[model samples]
Target: MPKAKLKPDVTVFEADQRQQEAIEHLHGPMLVIAGAGTGKTTVLTRRIARLISERHARPDEILALTYTENAAAEMRTRVRAELGGSETSQMRVCTFHAYCNNLLIRNGRNFGVLDDQDLWIYLRKRIRELQLNYFVRAANVGKFLFDLNDFMRRCHDELVGPEKYHAYVERLVRGELSIPRVTSSRDADSISDQEVLGRCREIDQVFQVVERMLSEENLGTFGHMISKAYELLNLTPELLSQERAATKFILVDEFQDANYAQVKILRLLAGEEKNVFAVGDPDQAIYQFRGASSAAFEIFRNQFSQSKVVALEKNRRSTTPILQCAFALIDKNPAIHATENNDAAENGGRRFQRRPLLSERDEKAGPAAIKDPVHAVSLTAKDAECSDIVHVIQQRRKQNACQWKDFAVLYRLHSHRDMVAEELAEAGIPFSIENMDISNTAEARDVFAIMGAMLAENDGASLFRVVATSD
Candidate 1:
């Protein structure tokens, strides 16, 4: 028996050329254009570790934020692994909402906001109540209300609160301003001055309800969570100053997915020192549906003209052909391609193209190697029987000479699974459906009962549903 050799852990001094550049350059702002599997996480965690272990940065002052709790946890885990428990324990790695909640708990009262409000729990309920009240009679106002909620949230993300929103409403109601033509859910109306004014009034009504609720009841919406934090930072200058002084560096993960409000929060926290490290790929910006602005990343990068941009060109994930195909697919979009190239070039990627420079995986993981490894075969009710699909699966299993675990069947809609499942069963093939469609699940019905009870105290139906469905 032989013991495997354990290589010495790579120190900051021993970092790869590009990673070393990102980790060592800690003075001002830096943007790392790290593509998928480029070890952006490596750069981020290592940089934080470097600051704690070498630069004498107070762990408390370093704020590392991400879009999701999962990402924050991942970064925290990496930092913990990189710089022992003592150093990582003092640092704050959190999502935007959690970080804002921290500020709210500490300094929100100083700004007269989030002080007595149930911003975290009842915000959604409050918004829904307002929409039901204000737009009860409007046609298809339910859909419009959904969009209005998003529009207001975007305002919050942009650090625009009730007062600023009222100003915009005044202009719109007066026909002095025109709504920008939009292709998003936020697009309400701007057909004519009269129509625009009508829609403006509708929006204003919803906002007025929101403001009154917040001011009188001290209850706020999710929008207020972020915007109020921005407000708290602004209204309490001393607190902001103290915070800026305390925070030496801010590292933002998935910068491309950051909407306007999150980006603004980071910038304000960065303050004049501008010690922020943001790592993201513009090509990977896919949060457009929920008010994320990919342009926010580019705008921030350009704001600091002297900010060093490092491109993590080599990818450790996908094979070259797959990367090439992805590049070509995304490059077809003129806007995305242009943004990627421009940012990459500015970020010191002279040879930067719309796609990432990919390397070989341990084994081939590309289209060329796997000839239609998975394909969807459309079926009609009249198309023979389920055997068509089951037989295909069987043939593929035998041809590839793989086990049942190696094969998979996916459905776009969950209900569509039953028919294929029945076929699989009849064919004596084993299969499993991955995602849950709550409508067909007892657990979901129980949840509905609970939510229904919360929404209406006197709803006998929901109450009975809860009692009857109880395990």
Candidate 2:
């Protein structure tokens, strides 16, 4: 393979030294600790471009896994821009689930895997058959199905199949396993050990039924797709080897948000070559509820002994003050220590390598020119807080002559929005809530009426709705 060189005309050549280093690194397991506002995507896309342009690897041999479809599309577009459509057409840039789905679609028939939609439909159809001690009533069937789906997804993400879940629940039943009593919320009732065990047993029962149904019908869910792919690869060394041979370079974006099954699939695909490039910030891991591992960074380090760690600390977006505020907040995490040795074994052995963000923006230009970028406000009550927000918006609009669309109020919770919306309405200020249901809106009703009129020309109700809504 030729040494990867940065061409002066290439955008990657203009990247900072650290980014250039990360891009130039062609082999071995590497971890890029990309903090917020850092150009991780730019580095990742350019690296792919360099790999193809310098003949280190062909576009088809590289696999880039991203957290979202948008991210994957952006990466593909950037790589295409750098290397052109002809050279980059064969490259694979997709989400972990997408990759697994594709893999299963191509090679999963040998192990009897069915489509995810079919699996879901089967589960819904057979939900009544899975007799459970709790949530078995007709009224609670919907809740049971929802919880069952969530539980199954979590189990699959953690690589815990029905057998594993059943075994674990049996241990709990036999008193071999114990759970610590921790109240998740002050207002929530504390669950007893017996209650926990009961729920676990019920979930296990549902899980086993679902698994059996899947086995009998060869049906699989989205989560099962990933798990089944892992199983297929692990059970068949020849197939695994073939995949590893085809995949010369593996680049994972948002690796911190990757679940256990995703990491396992990556491990199998990377194999002994370990030509894996993972870029993520552990602190930015916000998908724990979705089964993302908090110890993802540590797991990567432990799995790849020859892994090289790099930090992209230069934030191209935020100002110095904003960076300082962010640093102060994140530095409190024990994982962000400078270094961890035996002395720090008590503190989870230092999972992260600290990289303080530095602002690349010019202090005297644009938004960076603002003297006070951050503000702290304390309100004694929710009512007061909402009032204060309304006051601020009104004052800002009056002072700057800004339109209502130019201002935005963000709430940490949807519940908080109700009071704020009421406050804004009382103040005669117009605002729109993101993700609000628009089905009842006048525009949506108008569209629905038009559609109904077109589809049901003879229906009196459809004609009435159209006439009522029309000008």
Candidate 3:
């Protein structure tokens, strides 16, 4: 495969100081504070290319961490285009969960675990022991299972052990127990003891079977992979040393989105002298609900005292108006470090906009630099803000503003997606859910069946025929 040439200034749009620094550094624990649309993906791809071409790091030795399989695929595609070929395939471009799966599957029997379902069940039992709220309404076993599966994927083994999951569960139950009293003053409180009791019972039943399976059948989850990997590394430090010896660089994208288990894996892999680069935006840290901590950056900083912090704040995505609106919305959280001050006029600037020339400036000034000024607009009231946004969206629709493909509705949680999903449904608007795995589809049973048959005695054709006979 031909190598994609390095042309950071020309190839990548808005390749700013921070991004350029990240691309060229090729050393130590470095944190890239990549703001939205700041060409983070571009920098990452270039960084990977540099690692392979200049640093002489084998593609297989470098690891690129992502949040989702789709993001992983996107990263792989971009990196492949950047480096050009089966080269990027050698590099492990995967989510934290996928990395865990790789570790666990490769070394399953060492932990006395076999089969994913049994592993999931075992992990669920431990989660219950930890008293992790199987659901908002515990009686909702379906919801519990759905959430449990996801939770298991994230921290399978951490919950498997009695310590972490136990503490997590205790805290969760205590919080739930206090919810009723806390909301008693509210005239319209939603807390229900009956719901909790039912959910608790369902959890108890599910856990009982899982506990039995773990003790009797010896099963575990993906967290089991992390835990096992840690154990294996500890048990064979020389092996990990060898692995680290080969890896000249390990770049973790969206580092802030990583949980405890993942950080542990990286810490172990990075060891003492290995170079590690983590790029993410803490302001966009939305997975606190799922146990991700931005504090990993702080920890890494402290651990590697020589580390340099780089901020890729100049966004090359939204227009002045869009950036202003997005930034305003993002700043609602207290944790955000407000670099752009109260006065939006001078401080705020838009790096990029999608469209034809709107102003007289464009007509006279040929094409402005991609880093042309963008003015920030403050949103005073929720209704006014919504109205303003609706107007822009409506205008876009009328003028063929941006293609439906260009438009995206982003939120911090699945629950937040509900309103838009419902509205889209009612309006009969067709849209597909992005950044989700095919394995997460409602037809996961079919996938499981196919996988099971492929690995088992039965052929996939026979299993498909059997599964297709729904009636």
Candidate 4:
């Protein structure tokens, strides 16, 4: 596929110079620190467009990496529209794993790696050989570990440097054995080992074997891919140089959510050039449980000589009171590293307008017999009509009255829907429940309609064959 064309020159608004630097800066490692709703994505999209238009980066060479498929799609759609391209064919956008798989598959023969389908089987077998006991015991512990590692990394980034965090992790790992020894030595009357615990240990041993094999193959997991991508690029100077030459600028969104592996990948890709821009909010960095290292953001200036940090504190969501409440809660986090500029502290100091939530009893108070303008009527009975009226107010607040797609219900339990749904019906509000089994719902009808449409075309036989094979 050909490269994506550059977007037209346009001045993009970033809250500060740091944001502008991230959006307009070309080449090299950079970081932008902002709070939630601080236009991080907007800055990132503009940066990508700026690189293509001004920096002359080829669409293929400029790899846009994201954490999820939904995020990738969002970026791809934006880039495609901005650059004007055959998105499906030209855009080389994907999550880190997807990107690595593509790289391995396309260049697999160069590294003696298997094809995509075969690679999965190969990795599974190798992981089994690794014999990682943690994974074997719970079957999901490996994922949990990765998540926990990410979260820990983010916490470390926001509080301390990676070196300190690394040391902390090492100490924790070494301390695990001491607890059991200490307990055994202290209590001579207690049994040496519990039977159930022994059985669990045996399973752990089996998992360790599987984990050992997986790590040995070096086929690469998500963490491995982020780590290996850097190594691969660093080793291949020509390819690395080509990417640097083609793409003048690099911008990363949600920079706080970046783990060490991702930071390494960005550093390698950026090389010595000072064109890379990273943007994220430290306050919304709740993903530290994943391998997202916040140090990449908190310590970017320290890590890179040319890096500049920017803070965007304006909030687009929440009222003044709501923002004040959230700020008050977030201030309680002891681990939050303060900035020299003290923007967060200054912004948070402003008092919020008071707006108290009505008590359940107050809300349940009945409407008075008098026509009141200043004081609102309160519920006083278990009357369904009054409850339904209240429910409508609550439901409308949660779900907008736009197209059918705009509405969604977030219920704690399925039974909780009856009252709200009945209220909606009484108010003549329209909604579609998406919880029904898709096979028995309108989705099935739509699928059949599309299938019928396809069958009417010239390639009807292929469709028929597929249906027959499925059956």
lDDT per residue as tens, model 4, 1-471: 445665543533323554565566565565666666556776677677656655456556576667667788888777655665534335456676676555555555122222222333343434544455433565565453443334333442333333444454444455543223312235534634443344334334443443344345433234444444555676888877875665555566666676666665566666666566766765566556664554545445545654544555555433444455566666654343324233425674322221222122222343522222232346666455446454656576667654545455556555566766776676666766654445534346446545764766633323333343342
**Of the candidates numbered 1 and 2, which has the greater TM-score value?**
2
Q: Which segments of candidate 2 are over 4 A away from where they belong?
A: 1-13, 84-86, 108-127, 134-145, 173-175, 179-199, 215-218, 334-355, 362-369, 377-471
| C-alpha lDDT of residue 93 in model 2 | 92
lDDT of 1: 0.67
Off by over 4 Å in 4: 1-22, 55-58, 80-92, 109-208, 215-221, 234-247, 299-302, 334-429, 432-471
Candidate with top TM-score is: 2
Higher-ranked by lDDT: 2 or 4: 2
The sequence of per-residue lDDT tens digits that candidate 3 reaches over residues 282-365 is 666767655666565656665556666666666554555456556667656445321211222454632111212122223334
Poorest 10 consecutive residues by lDDT, candidate 2: 336-345
TM-score of each: 0.72, 0.74, 0.64, 0.55
lDDT of each: 0.67, 0.76, 0.59, 0.52
- In the range 18-47, model 1's lDDT, one tens digit per residue, is 878888877888878777877888888878
In candidate 3, stretches whose alpha carbon ends up further than 4 angstroms from where it belongs are 1-14, 84-86, 108-160, 163-212, 215-218, 336-439, 450-471
Cand. 2 TM to true fold:
0.74
lDDT of 2 by residue, 1-471 (tens): 444443344443357888888999988988888899889988898889888888888889999999778788889888877665534668999998788878777884423332333344446666678877756753767655665677788898989998998898888788887763423547335667877677777777888887886666554567777888899899999989899999999999998898878888888899888999999887888787778754777777767766777778788877778888888888776563222332245574444556578777743375636456778899887579999988998898899998889888988876797899999999998787776767755577657657876887544434444554445
Candidate order, TM-score descending: 2, 1, 3, 4
